[model samples]
Every structure is written in C-alpha cells, then in structure tokens.
Target chain A: MTLRLNLLIVLFLSFSALSFAQNNEIPAVDVKKIDGTTFNTGDIENDGKPIIINFWATWCSPCKRELNNIAEMYEEWVEETGVKLIALSIDDARNMGKVAPYVNGKGWEYEVYIDPNGDFKRALGVNNVPHTFLVDGNGKIVWQHNSYSEGDEYELFELVKKLSEGESID
Target chain B: MKNYSLLTSAASILLAFTLTFIGGELKAQQGIDDVLNNGEIRGNFQLEAQYYQEDSLIGAQDVPEKILSNGFLNLIYTNGSFSMGVRYESYLNALLGFPEGYRGNGVTYRFASFTQEKMSVTVGNFYEQFGNGLIFRTYEERGLGYDNMMDGVRVKFKPAPGLSLTGITGKQRLFFEYGEGIVRGLDAEFYLNDGISALANSKTQIILGASGISKYQPDQDSRYVLPENVGAVAGRVNITHGFFNVNAEYAWKANDPSADNGYIYRPGEALFVQASYSRKGFGLVLAAKRNDNMSFRSDRTEGQQNLLINYLPALTKQHTYNLLATLYPYAVQLNGEVAFQADLIYKFDKGSVLGGKYGMDVQFNVATANNIDTTMLNDERTTRQGYTSDWFKRGELYFQDINTQITKKFSKKVKGRFTYANLIYNQDVIEGKPGVPVIRANVGIADVTYKFNMRNSLRTEVQFLLTEQDQGDWATAIFEYSYAPHWFFAIMDQYNYGNEDPERQIHYYNASMGYNNGGNRITLSYGRQRAGIFCVGGVCRVVPASSGLYLSLTSSF
Candidate 1:
C-alpha cells in the first residue's frame, strides 16, 4: 500500500509539471442557441472579464443542482464582477426538444446554447457534464473544476471576482 | 518480453520529460510570459476500481478477481491547426456489468488531423454522427464499455459559406479489432441563413441536408441468403421563425436480413419531427417519431445493443430520481413503435402571488410510446412485406410518463425544489418477460439546500415511490455537506419497506467523501448497491447487486 501511494504521488507531481498550460480561446465550433440561431462559441467575448462556461445535461442531477445554486446569486455576480455564465446543454437529439423548456422552466438567466452533437464538448476534451471552466477576458482558460458539491459555487465565484480584479490567477 | 520492454521504455521516457519540465517550476512558479512557442500538450486520466464481496441473499457473488479496475489516459498535442491525440485504455479484468471483452489494455484510439483553409482530413479512429444519427453514427460511451469508433479515413470540406460536405470510409471497431464489414458514407448540408442574401439574419432560417451510407460484408450463412451490400439514405430540414423552430428527418434503408428482426427481408423506415417555441418566461416543445424494422449494424449477426449504426432515442422525460428512473425507464423501441412527447415551461415573476421574493419556475412534460398498428400480409412467407402498418396508428401502450417539477427560492439561504412523476410501464414488452404485468408507479421528491455561511452548505433529498408491482414501495433519504473549494461528504439510504417478502426487505446504504484541488478530484465510497438499470441521458445499463468499496479519480491538464 505504501509503495502504491508513493508511485501515485510521484505520478501526480510529474503530471502537474509537464501538463499543458494552455491559455487557449474557445475553439471555433458551430452550436445552436435556444432561439434557433447558430453561433460560433469562439466568437463570444466578455470585454475583458471572466466567463463561466458550464457543460450540463438535463439528466445529470449534480449539474441541475449547481446551476440552480448559481442562478440564485447570478444577478449579484454580474453586478459585482461583470462575470457572465454560459450554460451548454449536451442533451443530443434524444432530449434536444426539452432543452428550451427545461431552461426557461428553471428560470435560469444564463446564456444557454445546445451542443446537440457534442461538438464543443469534444473540442474541449470534456469527459463529463457539470464540468465548469473559468475563462478570462483574453479567452484563456484560467481554472477548471469537475463535479459539484453543495458549496462549490462559492469557490467559483471567488475566482471570478479575482480575475475581474486583474489578479493573475495563472 | 518485447512488449514489456516497450512499455518500460515508454514510461521512462515520459518520466524523464516530466522531470525536466518541472525543474524550472520547482524553483519558481512558472510565469505566464514563459510559454513554449513550439507547441502545446494536454490530456486527462480517469481510474476507477471496486472491491467486491459476496452476499447470497441478493445473488451477489465475488469475482475471481476481487478487485477490478478500469483506467483511461488521453494525451493530445497541438501545433497551430494541426493536432494529434492518443488514448490508452486498460480494463484489468473489467468491472461488473461492463463488457468482459475489454479485459486487457492497449492504445484503443488514435487520430491525427490538420486544417488547411477550407478543407481538413483525419486519419485513424474517429467518432462521427449524421443528422440526428438516423442513418449512421459512430461513438463511444466509456461507462457502458461501448466504443465503436471507425478506423480509416474521414474528410470534411467546405467550398463556400453555408455549404459543407463530409465523407468517410472505415471499418467499425469491434472489441479490440475491426469488424468484417466496410462502411462508406457522405453527407451534404446547405444553410439558407448563410448562403442566401435575403435569408441572412432574416427572421426565418432554413437548413437542408442529405446523407447516404452503405455497408459491405460477405455473407457466410448457408441457411438464408443475405445481401452482400446494403444501403441507406436520409434527408433532413430545419427551419426557424422568431421563437418557433421546426425540424424533421426521414430515413430509408434497403432490405438486409439480420437476426435482430428475425431475418425479415423488409425495408426499414424512420421518421422524426420536432418543433418548439420559447420566449422569456415560457417555452413549449413537441416531438413525434415512428420507427419500423430500423436496426442497422455493420455486422449482420450482431444483436443486443452492439455495433449499432444509429441511435434511436426514446421521446420521454429522462428522470434522475433513482426509483423514478430504474423502475420504469423507457427503452427506445427499435423494431417498431410510434412515440410523441410534449413539454411546457412557465416562470412566475418575482413579487407575484406564486413567486414570493424569488420567482417560481414550473415545468411539465408528458410522453407516450406504443406499438405501431400492424397486420400480417397474405401469404406471409411468400410476401416480402413482413407486415403492414399505418404510420400514425397506435396500438398497446408500451410506456407513458407525466412528470412535473417546481423550483422556488423561499429565502436568501433556503432553496427548495419539488417534483411529482407518474409512470406506466409495460414490463413484459420492455424487459422481454412473458408474464409480468404493467407497472404503475407514482414518485415524489423534495430537495432543499441550506447555506449557513460563505463557504459551508448542506443539502438534503427526500424521495418516495409508491407502487405494488416491482419491488414494492421504496423511500430514500440523502444528506450532503460541503466545505467550499476542498471537501464534501455524503450519505444516502434506500429502504424497501414494502417488499412482499419481509425477510428480503433491506436498506441499501452508501457513504462517500470527495477531495478536490484544482482540476483534480478523488472520491472514495463504500456501499450496497441494488440491482437495477442505471441510466444517463436515457441510455441505460443493468448494474447487478453488489457490496463493495469504490474509488474514482480524474484529473485534467
């Protein structure tokens, strides 16, 4: 057990050092808006503020919970840091019909888009939904986290605040 | 010995590079200004393991390999518009409910592609899906041990704005090797919003698309002659006007007898139509679909959710509550079925009667699927037409669900969500059981969240399902605690109190803890899992009963 733990630690440390530290803009991919308009996700910008990109699905419980939590403080977040939230539904054709209704019914004010074919998700190398990323104004991915606990939004909000204040998160 | 040496050499080289890269970071935090101008490397890894134990009461038995593990590592490198990636996957003895065919480990997926102006080409394994995947789709669902990505070449081209074309020729992946059949397909799409000047930015937008796919395989069966080559064609149209959007697709396939449809030499047909309208506070959507003998696969004899060339999703609500999902989840009827779904969403403004301080959101969805009315033709053996069916006629009720959910924020720190779902499921038809009666279940869920501080919170879920069919009534309670940025703990229990056999009534309990740091996470759990269908986005797999310890870790860089 000790040896295994040691090997794991070494592996983790090695990856942390050699891993890609890319400050890449969102890839140019065609995704549809709830209103049926097609837009390139890479063309989206925030005038040098932070953008919260969340990948979610209607069937993922954790995703809904995190989104709901963010909705409660969305107005304050926008007012305080000029941060914007973009929610992408990876629902596919099976439940693509429910994306619009589910979004409106949830009363979330975030900018919503549908990646019915998961083109954007694949480009980002996202393995699961509920994956959240903090993209800086320059379109560089500043930080990211997987999974959702009850209080995760607090951590995310703090990062947004920092990035908006011109604090170097990288 | 040769393979062992190759693996060792690869590991050493990787280790040396990592150490060299980290030498500078160890002394000083890598500055953003310092970036390698040459290229960029990124990847992710996930590892999951479970330790099993035997429990005779539930028919759970320990595997010879007590601890089974599955691991995946993906590495990608990019320079300008040119890029390459490879995925290494290992299934050490595989896991419960996972296909045992993936018992070993190797580099299962690899691809290299580059974009040059308006054209790009990819070589090696790739995932591609046509419009709504009615005719052809190649994808991977790792959790289900499903990966049928094509191996060969794919090309995507665009000569003008609003017009695009794609072509691919490949052999589908079957387990560790390529399948016997060869597949070729091409698709053309035209977008009016981009192509035509008058339609540009117009309230009305239209997109037209067509696709054709063909598969070739040598017939080996002597009992019945099978077509050496089968073809399918599909067409789709999508239009949007203001808040209203309409989309439809139809596909037709040449007759190719297979075991799935009892070797019936009848042409396959599928039609899908959907429309939706949405404004600020309200949205409405409706969809209809009909499928007849439309099971297409590269391998002729492949059955039971293997080597599927297309995806036919059930037009129904995808429930999340465990009981609501497992007991009556609807499987898309592949052979013959007609289905329809409708959804309505409304939001009551804040300060309104039902909105209180925070607005109230409500959504209701209803869907139903039934057998297509069919009658056998005269001289069934001689007539190539297996059966006659009306496009719109509906027969027995295979599945039905009506669910509604409401969300309201009562206070600054308290938020609640409530849901009610009623389902009617035909167990015999869906589960392929002969005598089981239809199951009717009503389920309710109350979820509440409490925030005590800036960094601390608690969430609770109370769910109850009432039914006399299946395993009787079930109730579940879950509580979770989170400390922002770092830690989370949760406990849940499902009690089957209404089981017919009192001795069999038991509590399925689980507890878990998670630690998160940046893009990395690790979770440890111990639990008793009940046998049921575990689903994600309407796709499901049967998870056998088990008592085990689970560990999962994922990291991205």
Candidate 2:
C-alpha cells in the first residue's frame, strides 16, 4: 500500500510540474520576423495594433505564397486597421543567406526577422508548416490556423478586421 | 502550527487514498484509461518471447538457439495545458535474431513536455521526423527491434495564420545511451493563400515548405577529412484542384562518404513526385522517386547500424504475407535508385454480374527501381575526383514487380480474395554480398472466408510461388477458425518443395490459438519461422529461422 501511494504521489507531482511549465513557456515568435534581433512579445501589442506574426522559411512554397500574398495587401491592411504583420524566417545558416535576397525580390513591406535556433518555433508545438496565429493587442494568441488555401485568407482577414474593430471573432 | 500540520496530514492522506483506489482498480485488469483525466496516469504494455532452431537445408549454421524478450511501459499524465510522459523499456538480451547491443533493461525515456496556444516544447527523449523523413527520422520499430530515439529538445510555433516553424537539437539513440553526433534541424512552411489577393478565387490551391538539417560528429581519423557538418535542404510544394492532388519535393545533401565506398565523398539528391485522383469509389495514385547518394550520416566509419541522419523513402509495397514477403524484401540503396509506383482501386457497382449480391473491389499496383548509371572511375590516377554517377539513366533494373488483388463478397456470409504478383530482385546490393541467385519470381494467393453466423467464421488461404532461383519454388496453406469477440484458432504451413537438392528442402507448419477478453489478448503457437529479411523503409534485419513455441500477451491500463 505504501509503495502504491508513493508511486501515485510521484505521478501526480510529475504531471503537476509539467502543467505548470507548459503554461509558463515563452510564446512562439513568428520565425519569419525574428531576424536574429531580440524582441519582446509586448512590443507589438504596445500600440493598440493587433499583431500577426508568421514563422516562415525561404524554401517553404506555401510560406512563400502566404508571405507574398500578405505583402501585396500589407500596406492596405495597415492603413485599414492598426495591425502589424511580422514575418519570422526559420531558415538555418545553410539557407539563411538567401532570406534577405528572397524577401527583397518579393518586394514585401512587412517586417522580417530570423530565428535560426528556432527558439520561438520550439516554444510552440507546431508539427506542420503554414500554421498561423492571431494575437490580440494584449499579446495573447486568440486564433490559430494550420494550412491555407486562397479562400482561407479572406476568412482570416475578416477575423482580423473584426478583432481589430473589437468585434467577436469566434 | 498544529492546525497547519493537521491540514497537511489530511491532504496527504486524501491523496494517498485516491492513488490506492486507482491502483486497486488497475490490478483488476482494466482497459486503457482516458488520458483526459488531468491527474490520472494511463499506459500500455506488450511482451513477446521466441525460441530459434537451425535447419541444415539453407545452410543456417550461424544461427543460435535463444530466448528473446522485449517490453515497454508508458505513463502519461495531462493537467490543464500541461502534459508529460515517461516510457521504460526492458529489452534484456533483446532478441537473439536482432542486431547487437539492444540487450539492456532501463528507462529509455524520461520526458517532460507541454503545449499552449502558440508554443509547444519537449525536453528529454522524443521521436521525430522531418519532410518525408529524408533528412531526419527518429523512431522505434518493435518487430525489427530497432529504436533510434533521440535525446534532446524540440519546439514548434506558429506566429501567424499561414506560417509554422519547428526546431530540434539532440543526439540519436545508440543502445541505451546517446550517439556521438549532434543533430540539429529547422523546418518551416508558409501558406500562400493569405498573401495572394489575386488568387483568392482561383480553383487551384498551393502550399510550400522548406527544411534544413545539419549533423556534426567529431572525427579522430587522420586519413579522411569528413564533412563534419553534414547539411541538407528540402523543398516541397503541394497543389490540389478538383479531383487532382499533387505533391512534389526535392532534397539535396552535401557530400559525405562512408565505409561502403571507403570514404570517397559523393553528394546526394532525392526527388519525389506524388499525384492522386479520388472520387466516389474510384481512386488512382501515381508516385515516382529518384534517390542518388542521399544516405546522409554523422559517422562515416560506422557500419550500416547507427549514425544514420536520414531515411530513404521506399517505393515498393510493404507486403505482409509469409512466402511472398520473405523471398525478396526491397532495400532502398540510397546511393542510386529510380522508382515509380501506380495504384488503382475501383469498386464494382451493385446489381452487376461481377458484383453479384455484393460489390467487388479490385486493386492493381506496380513499382520498380533501378541503379543510377555511373562510371566506376574516371581514372585510377584521379584520386580526389569522385566517380561519375549520372542521376538519370536507368542502369539495370534492380527491382520490378506488379500485383493485382480482387476482393468480393457473395450473399452476406461468404467472401473471398485473390492476389497475384510478379517480382524481380537484385540479390547483390540487397543481401550484403553477391553470388546469391538474382530472383525472378511469380506468386499467387487465394483467400476465402465463410461466416456461419454472427459469431463463427472460417478462413482458408492458399499460396503458390514459382521461382527458378534463390530458395526455389514454394507452396503455402492456412486455415483459421474465429469466434466473434473471443477466440480464434489457426493452422499454417509452408513448404519449399522444389529445391534441387533433396536434403536442401524444408516444411514449416504451425497451429495457434488466440483469446481476447476485454483489453487483454493472449496468443500461443508452435511452428517454424523461416529465416528471412524483415524490413521497414530501406533498412532491414534478418530474422533467423526458429522452430519452437511462441507466446505473446498485450494489455493496456
């Protein structure tokens, strides 16, 4: 009986510790926006702007399209709503050199960063790419999407517009 | 102080009582508990035992008689936004027929992991794979007794609606400890849908991704300057429209040679193309792949056993039958292979003559691989310059096969299936060394199942194989009696009857019964397990012949 009790206690403690750690881990950054520069999550939400941070890579075809599409409408989106779009590139050193060139060639106006170590990526449990998260002005993630088609972006923008206007998104 | 102590005692006692209750319930042989219970621990376990005996016909003298045992216990707990689990494995002498050094009983993984909205993290041992697993794949294979668990840290995040990122760093498993090399990787995917203002109404959809992995292993050998930092980049794009879906990827790895080629560096590249069309009851799939020296690794000196930094995708069917599967299992030779496979499935409409009382389903598949043509060497004097190996040019077809299977049902109680396949294999590259007969073979199998009632059924299968080389011709038969939700009895036999030498012949037979009660299943059988190559992916482990009793038990809690 004592042995069983001890085992149970250990199990409970272990899970409790895990739960606590999970809630406290740093929020995942938009790998496409990091650019090796240190930035805080609060910086984007400081101004009343809703922030959309996307973790992307140069070779990721879906990411490339997603970034390019967003870039085409980025300026208009900023003017319409106080929303900041940040692209974090997760390209390692092998392909990191191509990040600036690729972004420049695309003529995207949004901010870009690098997370070569994937510190921000690992913080989030992303299994597949083209995953997106929408953060409120308070820096709390409220909505997330996995894969995207052309039509899905319209729905996402609608949600972002609603969220920026203080309308219910869910 | 006295009041505080009293409260603490009460809380502890309550916790103890709760644990005891759960443990007591578990001791009664209960099913797997739901993991949603934030404070409860759930687990599953499996154990197997086998004995081996040598037969002189195939010259199986190197075999040894031994008992093999392997089992694992996993405990998982989740509370609110946090979750964690630890798995312990006791391979103890592992399995005699398996690779060496897998013979220890220890806690293989002690992990703490958690996930929230945008971030998820894991520390300790984990299993992971990247992009068709061409660059890095760490996992476990019980049947083959191969586990390359990585001990490290991993994280994944998504900061926007169309982008996702992942990063990992760790060392792969070598027996019970970590391998000598360090592996690190990054992968990201972006969806173009959100950014494409003009393509919003287009019927076509596209997703693109890129990934990179680097492996670092310190080398002490003075003779060779191995690419200490082996790296690879992979890109994939997927598009779908109407009934058509296509995914294509290209991966390239820097030059890093190995013991197979005496450390002569050769770069590697792999290209994958897959397309499928599915609607209603009809589905068609086409896949083609080309692999050239894509066997990335951390340690070039190590044999084929460890230090594999990538897994070559197999283009052949993973057969499960005894005779057809054992004769020639395909192994992806990373250095050179170009293969393609096509699969078609069509179901006959009801009320048709071929469909009879029930619809009939037909499946056909064909796959083949060949070596990449290459100049053995430009000249003996050109020491540093590597051999010229062309990426294209179907050298000699190393493997080729086609299979057709049909399943049909008559009335409600009778059903049957017929399968036929023709296969060819190159024994030299697949079986370590040459001189063994290169196999050109045809196999046919027929299976019939008859159900007398809701609870009783009988199944019979017969197989005939015709081959002129290797182990000669073969015949097989199996009969099974099953009672719904409870018991099953079966008898199986296989004979190598067409061998040239009379003494080089063998017949294997087994009778077994399996009982399933609730969450527990137990099986017992006595027979001869033939010596054959059991493979997963491109890797293979030879399962030696065994003539003995076998038992297996599995349960979850």
Candidate 3:
C-alpha cells in the first residue's frame, strides 16, 4: 500500500511540473447573471481587449475595498486601454440575495455575476476572495494576485497598460 | 480495516484507469500535443501550522503536541466534457479547537463526472444543495473544519432551456467515516419565462422549485422504539419585476426523534421569505425566517454541528469589524427560533452637499431573533410529543442588533468610514450559559486610509465597545501599511479594561506580515488570541484563546 501511495505521489508531482510549463486559460463553468439567469463563463469577452476577472464576496471587507478602489478609476482605465472588469461574487445561498442590492447601492459600473454554489470558484482553483486575474487579448491568463492591499489597483492598472501596449510582463 | 482496504483498491483502480486512458489517447494522436491542447489540470493547496505556548493567564490550555498543522491539496483534471478530481487532507494530531477525528492523513475526496448533451452524471464524492438548502445541503467550510460532502451517485437532466431535474442517492460523510443512514433526494426547477414561450418576453419573471429527501437508518437502540425512515419536502418560488424581487421557501419534515431536540417526536417545519428593491444608488432588503424542531440529522445521537442534513440560515447582518463580529457573533438556534432582518443602503451624489467632492455611501441594518412560544402537554412523556408552539407568539429575545455605517471620500488621497452599533445579546440561550443575564452594549468605530503615493498607502482603525457584563468594556486599534502589489504589514491590539477583576483584564496584541506573488501567498504572525466564536453564514465553531506563532501558505494554478 505504501509503495503504491509513493508511486502515485511521484507521478502527481511530475504531472504538475509539466502542467506548470503550459499557458493557462480560464475554465468554462456556469455562473448566474444579476437578473437570475444562467450564464456560461466561456462567453465572457471584451472585444479583444484585456479582461480583468476579480473573485470577490459580499462579506469580505478587503474584497469590497479592492472593488471600490478600482471603481473609482474604472472609467479612466477603460478610456485609455479599452479594458473590461468582471466581478464574480462567491456568496452562497444564504447571502446570495444581498449581492445585487449591494452592487447597485454602490453604483459600481463593472459587470457582476454570482456563483452561488462556488462551482466557478472551484473550477478556477481560487482559494480565497479578492483573487484577481489578468487575461490578455488572446484569452490566455497572464498574471494573477491572491490577496488585496491598498494601492494594489494601481499595480493592476499598470499591468493592463503593459498588456494593451503589446509589452510582455515577467 | 476493511474500509481502508476497499478505499485503497478503489484509488489504485482509478489511477490505473487514468494512466491507461492517457496512453491510449497518446497512441491514437501520435503525439502529446493533442492531449496538451484539449486537456487541462488545475488545483489549489493550503497549509496552516501553529506552534503553541501555554498561557495560564488567558486560559490557554497546555498542548501535549507543541506543534500542530492542517493541510490539504486538490487536483482536478478536465478534458472536454469529462473531469475527475481528488483531495488529500492531512491534520497532524489535529489543531486545537478542531474535531479530534481528523488525526491522520488520507484522500478524503475523489470524484469523476461527465456531461453529454443535456445530461450530467457524477459518481463518488460530491456536494449538492436543494433550493435555499432548507431540506438538504452538503458542502465544506475549511475555516470551521466543516465538510459534509456525499459519497454518492448523482444525475442531472435539463429537459429544456428553463427546466431542470436532479436525482441523488448517497451517504453523508462523518469525519473519516460515513453516516449510518442512506440518503436519497429528487429536485425539479422550472423557470416560467424560459419554459413558456408566451412569457418569454414578459416584464415579470418567475421561477418555481420543489424537492423531496429521505434517509433510512436501522433501528438498533434497545431503550426506545425509533423510526427507521424519515422524509422531508420543500417548495420555493422567486419573482422579479423591474427593480423589485421576492423569494420565499417552505419546508416540512416527518417526525423522527433525534439528539438535538431531546428525542421529541414532533414534526419539523421552516419558512423563509425575503423581499428586496434596488436601483442605481439605493437598495432595500427585508427578510424573515421561522424554524421549529428542524434539526434533521442522519445519525440519531450525533451533536455539535455534525451530521446536519439541512441548513438553517441565520437572518442577521454578518459584521466585518473585529470587535463587532468576533465579540458577539450569533449562532442559529436549529431547534426553534423566529428571526427578521432589514437593510437599507443609499449613496449620495458626487457633488452633493452630503457627498463631498468624491461621494458618500451610507448603510443601515437591523436584525432580531426570538424564541418560539411553546406550551408543554399534560401527557408529554407518554405521547413523546414534546410541546406545542404558538404560531405567532414570540417567547423571549435571543439576539438583536442595530447598526449603521457611512463611507466618504475626503479628498483624492484620503477616504474614511465611520460606524455605530447597538446590540442586545441573551447569554443564557445563545451561548448555553446558565443563569447569565442579557448583555447590552454599544460599539463605535472609525477607519481611515491615507495614500502617500501610487505605490504606498496606510490605513488605520480605532474602535471601542461599552458593556456592563461578560468581558466588560473594550477598545481596539489597528494599523496596516502596504507597498503596492508585493508586501504588507499589520499590527493590532485589543484591550479589556473595565473588568471587575483587574487580573483578568488583559491586552491581546498581534503583528503580521504577508508576501503575495501572482497565485501564491505566504503569511507569518505571532500574537495572543482571545477566545471567541468564529462563524461563517451563521454556522459557528469555538476558537480557543491561544498564544502562538502561526504560518500559512496558499497557492493555486
């Protein structure tokens, strides 16, 4: 039994190493629109512009702060780079009802969706909220961040600027 | 021993099958590019370890194992419409305040699923929930060490664009084992606008759903006669028109005595209703819920957040502030309770008098819970009917809170939020404290952020609580500094100063720093943690007060 377990672990590690070398893209999963209709995540697009996918929840304080900060500069970013931001709320059934109201109350201009059962969240391998991902015009994920801090939106905009200008980021 | 061998064999078979499939695909394609282009593998990993130090002053118990750790890794492979995943969990000796059943390590979850046309099938472990989760739900909350995933087979069929059906047969997971009962359920949902062509373009949209669930457990007890089979049913409806929405659900369960309700044979019932209205800068929500003898479990004798077959959502504002959240968190009373909540949010314009230069946002919320009025029967022992409850009478106050918050931008580089709250907590009922009087308290907080440049910023919070019972008055202060996309440092102190006994009045201080780089985060901190109840969505676990050094790492691909 131990031998088989060891073999499985070794194989798994090697597979992970191989996968790490490949370019990752967003996974296709089912989410809900703010109006209570099912929407396929594969259809998310920004007309060949950079797309910023942000995973957040209504109850997470840092997630709210991050979204609010980005909201303040979203118009400017769009005008300059033709960027689009999509906010995904990972609120469960208990708190799902408050999401639309909360978003409307804040007057946020970004497109918002709900993942009530966290199916999309799990497919994306998201461990925590406020995890942001930057996707290039070709639909390939280029950069991602796990947590949020003050002034992080500035850094995110910088990446968007680079991606729009056809500059590579390491 | 037999179960262990069975699981090991199953895992080995799965691994062999996967290897064989990959080999065959490679041979058929004559290259690895086909598999690499169509197939994807993704997962996440998290680990938390704590080194404990005994502190008799704050009631932190000595640990025989000075170091404890909890960790898990998930790996999922998906190819087109087929996917398979597994999770390996390790709890070395289990962390303090966690269930002792998590002593070792194993593959706790494994599943294979496929979708073809409009039908989906899942075999092995899965998580599922019915409408509102009133009658059935199986999920995981890692923060509370709670997971009730089902080891089962499930089938879902979408007959049309707006109609769906699901059927499931499984056994609920209990720690490293399976519950004694076998569970089976069926659910159906219909969207009116999508299902009927006539209503497709209507202004009003409606959705209706219903579910039925049953569990079978063998009666083996010698002391009393028990029912072997229990069943529950629920129905829900949702309506939306313009900017208004309403959702409601009702559930009922057959009488099956269990440990949570003191072996009462009374049937269970629950009702939840919510209404909301929202526009661009204004929103309002009102909700109410009532539950009676609704603690349904697969096992008859299990207690303490275990083996729950249904979820009773707590109707309260989930506070985010430390003092307001951790100090007096409310837990749902599964047996019987009536609760209501109201919330209002409004945002002033950018250039208005109250909005200042940037804009201002205000939110007001109120929530309350009360015990169900009940009357004991004359021959309750013989009938085992327990007691009868009045449908409209409220017995006693369980919990209440009224709070409001205002957020304003002072300038281009400054933003602030202020909050005030009043709370009334019944210690005896909610916390299981006998003979303790109710606690009435007021809390206030001010949080502000200052930006020095585009890359550097600092945020601070000052908070205070005034109370005459329990831990008495308290104050807290927090400071955090961030350097853009990479690093952050935070420090906070919580002081209990108005205790009758100064010896018990102590200061809990903590400092932490974190580093984040694209999909990976690492944090290390050392601090004195005050004992409190930590909750998520009304479900709670007691977090013990401990002085320790903590480290955590999370990563995803």
Supply every candidate's count of residue pairs whose N, Cα or C atoms clash at under 3 angstroms: 0, 41, 0
- The C-alpha stretches of model 3 lying farther than 4 A from their native spots are A1-17, A20-23, B1-37
lDDT of candidate 1 over B1-557, digit per residue (tens): 64454344433433333334435454221311122333355677889999998877766787888999998987765545555567888889788988667878887877777666788788888888788888988877777777778998999898898888899999998877788899999998888788988878688888898999999999999876789899999999988787788889999999978877777788998999999988778989999999898999999898766777887878988888777877678888788889999988898999999988889888899999999888877544674567788876888999999999998888878888899998899999998998998989899999998988877889899999999897889999989888887899999999999899998888999999999886788999998888888777556778789888999988876
State the displacement of the C-alpha of residue B387, model 2, in Å, after optimal TM-score superposition.
2.1
Cand. 1 TM to true fold: 0.91
Rank by TM-score (best first): 3, 1, 2
Ranking by DockQ: 3, 1, 2
Tens digit per residue, CA lDDT, model 3, B400-428: 99999999989978999999999999989
Cα miss at B375, model 2 (Å)? Answer: 1.6
User: In terms of docking quality, how is candidate 1 classified?
Assistant: acceptable
> In model 1, what lDDT does residue B55 have?
75
Off by over 4 Å in 2: A1-170, B1-37, B52-66, B194-203, B378-385, B536-539
**Chain A only: TM-score of every candidate?**
0.86, 0.77, 0.89
Standalone chain B TM-score for every prediction: 0.93, 0.89, 0.95
Distance from true position, residue B373, model 1, in Å? 1.4
Clashing pairs in 3: none
What is candidate 3's lDDT per residue for A111-162, written digit by digit as tens?
A: 9998877777877788888899999998878888999998899889999999
RMSD of each: 5.8, 15.1, 3.0
TM-score of chain B of 2: 0.89
User: Each model's C-alpha lDDT?
Assistant: 0.81, 0.66, 0.86
